[model samples]
Target chain A: MNDTTPNSYRTGPDERGRFGIFGGRFVSETLMPLILDLEAEYEKAKTDPGFWAEMDDLWTHYVGRPSPLYYAERLTEELGGAKIYMKRDELNHTGAHKINNVLGQILLARRMGKTRIIAETGAGQHGVATATVCARFGLECIVFMGATDVERQKPNVFRMKLLGAKVVPVTSGRATLKDAMNEALRDWVTNVENTFYCIGTVAGPHPYPAMVRDFQSIIGKETRAQMMEREGRLPDTLVACIGGGSNAMGLFHPFLDDPEVRIIGVEAGGHGVDDRMEHAASLTGGRPGVLHGNRTYLLQDADGQILEGHSISAGLDYPGIGPEHSWLHDMGRVEYVSVTDDEALAAFQLSCRTEGIIPALEPSHALAHVAKLAPTLPRENLLVMNMCGRGDKDIFTVAEALGSKI
Target chain B: MSRIDAKFAALKAEGKAAFVSFVMAGDPDYETSLAIVKGLPAAGVDVIELGMPFTDPMADGPAIQLAGQRALAGGMTLGRVLEMVRSFRVDDQTTPIILMGYYNPIYSMGVERFVAAAKDAGVDGLIVVDLPPEEDDELCLPANAAGLNFIRLATPTTDDTRLPAVARNTSGFVYYVSITGITGAASASAARVAPEVDRVRKATGLPVCVGFGVKTPEASAEIAGVADGVVVGSAIIERIAAGEDTASVLAFVKSLTEAAHGA
Candidate 1:
């Protein structure tokens, strides 16, 4: 009842603890008081130089920050686009941008003096990322993944297990990303004292979306610096795939201020937007509502019921996008679009065939757009897309989709 | 005044929140859900949310989803939910009724036809979990104009950046999720819900009713003392799932409502 409108989220856990409309303590009642406690504790930890030193030391030794930005010489020539360079986040220690966020959260968790780590995974990318970090930091890690996703993304599932993390397959709902998140939230609410919910994407309640975005913003920072060094100026266009939209926002965020930079986000079209089996493209087809935390676009129905979305790629099967993406789409700062299953598959195969880089299905959706949009733009125009993750875990899906001959 | 707005305005003028409960229209059996519906008002429930059975409920937790499945299993359809609402309205003229469910069935039923059916059902409001606020350009505008209050769930994640827009479309009470997760999880706590209620109240003038983790009389009582209204779902469904009789469930809820009112 107090005017939480302004001080709801302070830039740094605020007076009442909120972060610029993005981070607030929007947890369960059981978890709320705990979060307030954690927020207080986190504030103390953040102020301690020992915490920063520990994070910096781990940043260098454990999860390899300052990941190199590699110029895709071969891809650029083949695609014939304006100097298409990758942020090389796919080369990060965990082979994806997921770690950038998890590493920070895990480190923050440790700083908060939490002994256990919990997270949810859609394609097991975030699970593997969280598991990998927990192993290094010596934190007890538990991951919740949808049962169906566990079966499909077997390699990543096994990888989480190998990394010494317990994987709890959520069997609720469609048993996908959203369900896994529900389980993770449930875990956090129950074990708020000893546990930390390392959100996989920039989509959860306050503090989470903002914190994850800040952690992942390294992608944007690196891209901006690398692009300036090579092109002497910012690129004209930017594109990234969006499930929960961390990678997209991470890449587009820093460049948001750049007027010349045309930002684009690609969503999974599943069979196609027209098909019932389409990915949850909230902007093009979805409406705004509140889910996880802040209000953004959600794939709900007439009665405001969240509907399960279908996507061929497990990575982009979620029903909501990140809050920042919602703002960008509404402001018309970003052009939000989608690509179909067949097109993304073709692009996934094309990236492998032409550029020798097998991209994740998520980025492949972006690739599909890149492939279509690249050749059309003049050689002077530049197009850069965040290759959020490597395609190592997508072999089975790609092979099956390509009609693997036994 | 619109049916829902008028009911809530009266409640608000009296300084009370509406306790809304949702169940699959044909959960277990059409007649059983019907009996529960008619039985709810006297049980101290202010509003009843009828979930139209569908094949998929993405936002629903295992409990509501299974309830939907059971309703579907018992040959529940959109039409049946409508019939139940119509029948419930015969005696329950004072209490408001809202249909909360997914959109595919209504989309399949045709938005115009569904709106007409809802109006005919004496339905007061709606809370379509899957219907995005953006898509309301097509659905909610019509639902609002047709004298239906389309309630939306505003969560902790929906910060000020997006809260204004989501709140703009809301006509009925805002269903504030107490957790960052799904419905029916035993994770939500009053400690977590209070700030959210505080946040949601800041976002809109609409009454804020918190749901998701409320499973006990103590929990509902605790939340009700703070929030404008308290929504208890999974606990009720869990009882139904566990084969608890409806009569006891209603009695338990009525007493819980009293507890919530600080009785």
Candidate 2:
């Protein structure tokens, strides 16, 4: 693998949708035409001002975008090092960064005349966002959630149900995000005529990793402007949690070429990144293998059977990272680290007490990394971490972890 | 000619469709699965599609999925699957053995090494469900280069514009998915599949084998009459899942093969 830096890292996933050797359209013949059609539509949408106008309008009004990049005064003082700023994407409608990509795909689906929207969710944040959009548009929504996740993320399941979406609990494999995605793909192959699969993360086939990254780039685009406004320059560092790495990709893509802005992505280190295979840190512990229509870093056995990844955060429980992140990791452009579940739980409480922001466990993994890094860095270092999700849905899980009654 | 092409040619000469049976390697247990596989040829099977068990089989239904789980639980690995093929080849060389599964396993064992090992283990063809024509360079070209037939599937969604692409690097028989859904979800109608089989055969100029929903002997006969071959996977797997002894499973397979050959 070549570690030489490219002139520009953003022009990736060439015509065949490959980010180096990571991403490609590795789907069945049944879904090839639909994927190709979707790609063509997305290419057209990229050039259409009308599409962006609609997206901008929806972002401003419905999703409440240009989400505030709040200075973490108390948290910074506690760390006594870098000035911390949180890009408050958890404040978006449906309470996560997932809606940013959901809206983009839903609009494209509308353009393509698809009325039935299907999605696979891990933490149910993506399901809620997809359900919310489908309700607003009166589109039929079906969310495939891991049966295990459905139990843990009960509140988000109810939120999706209240939004009129049918939540199908998948019981395949380890019954987690990967299995849910498998079920969703099966549904797409079965219902090729009218269904639009709104993938929740920056994984999956070619156009998906790229398309989701483009839509979620709004976070980084806004952050670039917001940081310039607040600090009179770009932030010195950026950090975000990665399940499929959508939020991290969103916040990091715009800064990839900047060279000076250090970027870090935290993966769920369930117990640890040791040989136990009890972690969701794909780039850190896994190797390249194909799953869910793309070749990326996958936690698989020596025989190539995908291993079930463990994580306290349901959203960070996936066994693979985005293909682009794999490419970026290979290129040495982004530093990928992992935090254990115990560390993340502590970070969750710290964020709640110090910053007065109850962070979702997904981004709590990121905050845990920030906590470790902030204390060592100089106070002048401007560190921006993506608060990609709110914690209301996770209060139960957190309380249980804390051994306290909710 | 490759074993797959030779078998198809022989079947064409006999004016009979090939009876292709799929079973997960090492399902239930390695010994029982091996016994069942060895019995397939005498039971009238023409081609064998040995499933290389994968952890995530998105295209498969409950029956095949459970079969894979059983196989994995029995400690089935890619190396062991190849060993099973090698064992099968010890007695039967005429029957085409195709390793059917996702790309990750073969990819995990490196494409070049896998293609070499599969070829060495007497694998005649491959049906990796996830690898479409767009990503043919990953495994298809290499496997084809190593004298193995890299088969491709042509689904109902594969339209006129996409048929040529799907068939371009394809060897062996083109698998025509009889339904739009995963395996074992629905039964296929020959009336519905016949025209689609004709389209794929014409486009690819190769034999078309219909699969995905062929469940019963009658269903197998109906589909065989329309296409060059009939593949029964989940149905055979269901019998295995039911814990039928190797002999009983072979008896069931023989019945399905008889219907296809008699068609």
lDDT by residue (A204-225, candidate 2, tens digit) is 9979999999999999999999
lDDT of 1: 0.76
Looking at model 1, give its docking quality level: incorrect
For candidate 2 chain B, the 10 contiguous residues with the lowest summed lDDT are B185-194
Off by over 4 Å in 2: none
Cα lDDT tens digits, model 2, B114-167, are 999999999999999999999988999999899999999888899999999988
lDDT of 1 by residue, A296-316 (tens): 677876554567777878888
Tens-place lDDT digits, model 1, residues B1-263:
66666767877787776676766788779887888888988887877878787544545677887898788668777877898999998887778888887655676567798898899889988887655564465468889888889888876656666677678877778888776556786556677788878888888888898887787778877888678888877777777777778797778778767767562
Q: Please tell me what DockQ candidate 2 reaches.
A: 0.90
Q: Among these predicted structures, which one has the highest TM-score?
A: 2
